[model samples]
Target: MVYTICYALIFLAEILISLFYFENKFERKASKKFLIISLPTAYTILYFARLFNITVVNMLAFFVCNFFLLRLCYKAKIKSAIFHCSILLVFNVTTEFVVMLFSAAILGTELLACLDNSVNLIFQSTISKLLYFSSMYILSKVSSNERRKESPATSLMLFLLPISSTLIIYAILYSLAEYELGQVFLTLLLIGIVVLLFSNIAVFWVYEFTLKTQSRNMELEYEKQKLKSAAEYYDLLNEQNENSKIVMHDIKRHLNAIKSIAKDKAVTEYIDDFIEDFSINKSVDYCNNPMANSIVNRYKSFCDKFGVKMNIDIRSADFSFMSEPDITALLDNLLENAVEAAQNTENGFIDFSAFVRKNKYLSIQLTNSVKNIVAVKNNRIASSKKSDAIHGTGLKSIKRVVKKYDGEINMKFNEDDMTFTSNIVFEIRR
Candidate 1:
């Protein structure tokens, strides 16, 4: 009965730890009732395995149970589910080995003798649980952000933690069981194991900090690129507008010259073509903000070149609430993604609309036809381009701007119609 109780507590602790890890990585789908039922079901399987003294089967059953539970209770891919389960299992095994080894050493007895006593079993399990929970708490404090992926170096180190812990435990146990190791040697081994454990935690914290720094730097670089692109687009539009003004100013003179040379059909046709090509009507001012207008018009030209139809409906409003750079980055990314998606379809088209609702909210929507819809993970649309690092930064930049303004953005795709849609809403703080 004591053994069963201890096993139940250990299993419950493992489940809670797994829950914390999964909650960080994936959305939860299971309810409280599901958890209540699943926990005992998992424990029962392990309990029966123990009854049959099937060590290998017990390990396999534990992993299988946790893997399926994670898959059923969370929105995670198979690879992610396996990775998480493996981490949990390694943590549990390492903690158990360390706690058992230390407990036996302190009790001055064989490891088997320690496990045979209910008092010792409870003590060992409690110590193991404390160590496991403490490590998890420190890890959470160290890596508070959602890490979409781990670096290869970090992954290798994480794998080594368990292996090293197991080896250390094995060496201590073998020394105690096979030979008479002195107190000094056992003490030193224990100290070394403790140091190794702390070092693993320190390394994890440092790697997480490094990853965070790298991520911030990438975002800063992306913002710089965004600003540069916006400035160039603004300048190009301004130059085109100036050229149109010059042509318009001399329109009367050109028309009169064309009339005079009407007898020569070639010259007259050439002048008429020039006027048509340099029509001032081609310049579009969609909003009160010049930068926003420039971004829209620039993408409009891109769509025209790609034989994609662009439909734009923008209202005049005071956009002084947003900085010029923020507005440019937001609009440029939206339009660029829309144009790129539309450029690939047979009947490619983009529908863009922006307006103020109730004088307090600015709502913008962009819908485009797509040949293939990209997958979204954690509410982020994954980049389909080969250069994920470069192509993915645009959306990340836009998200930063939206977050800065306490705005909301939604994205959706329709597989049946092969269309992608984005809606962004910002509260206008007057």
Candidate 2:
């Protein structure tokens, strides 16, 4: 009873360390219910291995078998998983032997026996848990915190499966060696430990490769989708604007010819024609943001051809508020949204302005014609007329950039004006 209790305590320590570093990657939050179930489950696996009494052959099996078990726990099938697990096992087994040697040397036999003492089993178990935790934390080839965006639920499976696998493998070796020659048993156990250590290193190397490959593949897919969507929307959004530019270009030639054909007295007709053409549209230009200006000019050129009056008053003095690239990101999204809103209207118009306010804040606002803007997923604006989700991300991305600066964003739709307006204020960090 005493020995078992001490063993249980050691198991608790190991589980706690594994869970703490593996789950949150910061602190270990031990849940009594979880430990009650997992400790025995882990220990039972260890007992079977110890009971077998052989060490050499069992250790070899432990390395390869545990990799497969880990793969199974992770939703991987046997055949496909074997290829990756093979590499992993070889590396891990090799690493295990190296660690086991160091662990015995540093811990010393006296300390090890004390932790495994028969008299004070609980204390022994606790010490064992501490040793296991330290070993796993320092020597294991895994760092849970490094895996971003991976589901945490799967983390337990990943951490535990290897442990279980190692247990089963060692048990088989211990069992086989129990009936073998004493020298044979020792040789096999030593060899098995070495194999197990190297296998872990191999698996970790392969695991890292697999993760990086998956991430890159995901990014590639995203880029492909972005380019495809951009192609489809590019024509729809800018078609009318392109036509307007062509018309304006033609009108320039018409005015020039009229000026040449008429004398000063009759030139009044040409001047009136030019004024009527000019008076119909008024464009506002704000700051000289090369990137922002380029984005505005492209859309403005399109708006002029389509008869949308664009008024842009853009300026940015707080270079410290944001980097030049971030400024472009904000402007590109806002103007894109503004252009879309205005272009969808019968009498389309876009008003944009930016300046440092009285409170030493950089305020940027864009108002463009829109009929209705509804709220759908918690403070997210949904288009009242056209239900497009892509537009949501553009605005959301802008909001994200703002939040990074600890700034605020306000967006509302006015029914009377048939306009959507956004007010963003950046509190520049001094």
Candidate 3:
């Protein structure tokens, strides 16, 4: 009965720990189902293996059960599941060893002998729960909010580090269980266990720090590229605005000549064609901001070239709350993506609108027809372009700007209508 109780408690602890690690990745219903099915089965197998004194089989069954449970419940790939399971197993072993050590010290009994008492077993299980929960809480607090997929090499490294450390600690515990140790040796072993525990924490901390640093660097590099693009766009718009002024001045000078030649059908036709050709490339100013207007007009020309109809409504919107670069980057990326998607569809059309809502929020919405099915991964729109890293940067840049303003961005796809919609809302800062 004591052994059964201990096994049940351990099983519950394992389920809780797994849920803590994978709560964000898995659905609650699926997680509950996994716990219900996997826990009892795994505990039964481990219980029989322990009863038969099959130590090696017990350890193998433990890891194998966890790997499969994580893979199926979290819907993770095999390698990712293995890495997660290994980390949990290492923590479990480390906590058990620590509890055993403390219980032995308090009871003045050999480490292995503590397992013979039901009180010690319950004490160990309770301590393990506390340790695991505390450690997970600390990790969750310190970890980055961005969820990046780990590289295979990094995942393998993470999997090995904890397992190796746990094994070393377990070996020390086994040695303590087998024979009495000198004071010097016992002290050294305790120090070694402490170092191993700290080393495990350090490894994970360094890995998370590396990921955060890499993400920040990528953002900086993208910002640099965005700034360069905006600069060139502004220059082109300024030149176009200047050329339009020149063309207007020339037209004024030719008005008298045009009126005199109006009686001649051939001369009038020539003058009208020249005016039309010159004005066709002129930029359309949409909002109070010239930079935004330039970007919209540039994309409008692109849409015209590709036979994608564009409807834009940006009459009295005030976007002065955002910087010039930010405004350009946001509009440029959104329009470019819309135009690209629309160009691929027959009779494609884009609808874009920006306005202030109730004088408290800036709202922007873009809807465009897409020929291919839209794919979203990790809540971000997956780029269909062959060079994903290059083309994917646009959405990332837009997200960065939105995040800076504490705004919300949402994307929805209508399968029936074959339309993709992007909505962004930013709180107006007084």
Top-TM-score candidate index: 1
Stretches of candidate 3 off by over 4 Å are 1-181, 255-265, 356-361, 375-392, 403-406, 427-430
* Model 1 error, position 245 (Å): 2.2
Q: Put the candidates in TM-score order, highest first.
A: 1, 3, 2
Model 3: per-residue lDDT, tens digit, 14-57?
A: 55555556653433335566667876776566556656546566
- Lowest-lDDT window of 10 residues in candidate 1? 382-391
User: Which runs of model 2 end up more than 4 angstroms from their true locations?
Assistant: 1-261, 264-268, 271-284, 287-291, 297-323, 337-353, 365-423, 428-430
Give the per-residue lDDT digits (tens) of candidate 1, residues 1-430: 5345555555555556555556555667789799778877876776676566565776787688889888888777899789767877777778778888776786567776755654445445555755675566446545545544556665665656645564555556555556766757755554454445445445555665576688788778867986887777787777778787787868958686766868988878877787777656576788778777778888999999999999988864546799877887788878877787788789899999989888889988888888775675555665455211114667877888899999998877777888877788999988
TM-score of each: 0.63, 0.38, 0.59
* Angstrom error at residue 95, model 3: 17
Question: 325-375, model 2: which lDDT tens digit per residue?
Answer: 455556666777777667767898988777777757888777888645544
For candidate 3, report its TM-score.
0.59
Q: What is residue 136's positional error in candidate 2, in angstroms?
A: 20
| Candidate that scores best on lDDT | 1
- By the TM-score metric, which is better: model 2 or model 3? 3
Residue 329 C-alpha lDDT in model 3: 74
